[model samples]
Target: MYRCDCKSNVLSVLLYVSECWKFTANIEKRLEVFQTKCLRRIMRIFWPNMISNEELRRRAGVSTISEIIATRRWQWLGHVCRMPIDSIPRVALRWTPQGKRNRGRPKETWRRTVDRDLKTRGLTLQTAPTIAADRAKWRSLAVASSTRRRRED
Candidate 1:
């Protein structure tokens, strides 16, 4: 709810430290160092009843899941899928197939991938006579240039 940049250094650190108190599910490793208790005092300001540290730690642990849990943030995600409001996508996101390609950049287009493999491996492209003719034409032009140069000498 609060922007850290707008605040002083002390307030910024407190805000940053407060967020760290909540565990993230996306994190792969147990970053024990990043998990600190500086936010323990600050949380009491909002929840005066004071949720116990054990309960708090348990809640944080649950948030870091491989799949989305029954959280408030994702409540509208299901609706967003069912009723795609507009044909035009507001944002473009990179799509990557799992297992087939892991890490690094993923191929943007299926046509691009098929074309690349065909050209390099001489598979599908060998049957395409147009491509074959283009290569033959280029080779003939190169040979004709050399022959003309020899005649001038």
Candidate 2:
């Protein structure tokens, strides 16, 4: 019942080592048949370093990335792989980055959300006046009142 500091179970850790060994054996056997000995062993053995064991599971046996999506575990695996940065689904992870906010803080536009139903009635901008217009009206009223005060004095 010893938990390795690497957070790997003893039995499963051994199984993972065995899987890596089997992978190397399979790769070597296939490559030997082709007579290509100059293949970089390190890259194939550990391709583009994954951050977690869950990600290792996803990469090792999951054939189609779409299979990962269908199971709805892609997001879990994505976080395990430190892949939350990419908005694209792993099935189509290479698509054009659309609506991605990169630089600076996100735009905090004051969208005028309404509680009224819009299905039957239409979108009508009835009396939502601009703040500047209201300010101007108040300023004109204040000026007129001050002028009246001076005349009364």
Top model number, TM-score: 1
What stretches of model 1 exceed 4 Å from their correct place? 1-38, 43-52, 55-70, 85-99, 102-153
Tell me the lDDT of candidate 2: 0.29
Error of 2 at 132 (Å): 9.4
Clashing pairs in 2: none
TM-score of 1: 0.24
lDDT of 1 at 115: 39
> Cα deviation of 15 in candidate 1 (Å)?
12
Q: Report every candidate's CA lDDT.
A: 0.33, 0.29
Question: Per-residue CA lDDT of candidate 2, range 54-84, in tens?
Answer: 3332333321221212122212322322334
